[model samples]
Target: MNQEIQEYNESQTTDIKDVCNRLAQIIDGNLPEAESKIWHRHPVWFLDGNPTVGYSIQKPGVRLMFWSGADFEENGLNVVGKKFKDASIFFQHVSEIHQEDLVRWLNKSKIIQWDYKNIVKRKGELVRLKKS
Candidate 1:
């Protein structure tokens, strides 16, 4: 566990922390290669040194974002921001988490490489490569 992650988790509300915890468990248990770290103030799960998924505490709720999520199935993803091929799903309560749906995405996420820089510079490059 990361110190930053520990601090962030401790500072959040119980519901928010619970959502974070569940997602962390899903990623950690399913993806042995993925490492949890604090990136841009959020807890991010990295695979092959690239950010695959991350969660942040926002004003509306806890936002779970996938770095190359634009390529992921529409099962539970919501396209977010016009800049990059990023997608997100928001959970207002802990009970809203669908473990199966999230785990499916997590499995798919590891196969895609997220170049945080190129994602902003050349949108969809990662997803395009993943599809090819």
Candidate 2:
């Protein structure tokens, strides 16, 4: 872990960090033996140099950004955050993350890594097609 991740992880409230850590562990568990790296100023889990997932700190929150969030059709994982118009899921607080949902999203991302164009299109479509 980088200093930033360590600092951010430590700075989190026990409840918040607990959730964040759990999320990380879930991602790691699912992608066992994969190499995880710290990049984009955050903790990023990768496989064979391809980004599988990313995480970052936010005001009063943390975000679990998936590389293929747009390809996720179930559980509304694509619309989990205000900035997710790209390909990320932001958890405003630890309480907002459902373990099952996060795991599903991670698995979804892993499965859809090669469908980048479709993923981007879906993300854009969701933002433009959905009504607030």
Candidate 3:
């Protein structure tokens, strides 16, 4: 794990900390080539400079978000963003995380991506970078 991300995970309250740690571990294990760091005050993983996946503590729980998850075609990530391709799921406990689903989503995240790295350059227009 990135030192900054580790510190961020460690800063959370106990239950949330476990969620963060598990999320980080799984994301790192699956996306070993992705660069991870604190982005916008949360831990995000970027693939070739494009944001892929991330997690943050929220009022509801620990939010695990995928930048282009709206098209992941998975039902578990129900909180789809209205303004972007982002989608997320909230986890109140570590046990709530289904490893199989998480792994499947992580795999989908690699093949399905949007051009978030240059969204500003395109005036917020998102173009597909890959497809399932």
Query: Among these predicted structures, which one has the highest lDDT?
Result: 3
Candidate 3 Cα deviation (angstroms), residue 19: 0.4
lDDT against true structure, model 1: 0.78
The TM-score ranking, best first, is 3, 1, 2
Q: Estimate each model's TM-score.
A: 0.83, 0.66, 0.96
The numbered model that scores best in TM-score is: 3
Kindly give the number of clashing pairs for every candidate: 0, 0, 0
What's the lDDT for candidate 2? Answer: 0.63
Which parts of model 1 have CA positions greater than 4 angstroms off?
A: 117-132
| lDDT on C-alpha atoms for all candidate structures | 0.78, 0.63, 0.94
- Residue-level lDDT of model 3, residues 1-132, one tens digit each, is 999999999999999999999999999999999999999999999999999999988899999999999998888997546779999999999999999999999999999999999999999899999555
> What's model 3's lDDT at 21?
96
How do the residues 1-132 of candidate 1 rate in per-residue lDDT, one tens digit apiece? Answer: 567777787788888888877777777788877778898778997775678788998888998998888877575799966767789999988799998898888877876555764555665454344422
RMSD versus native structure for model 1: 2.8
Output the lDDT of residue 67, model 1: 84
Candidate 1 versus the native: TM-score? 0.83
Window of ten residues with lowest summed lDDT in model 2? 123-132
- State the TM-score for model 2: 0.66
The better candidate by lDDT, 1 or 3, is: 3
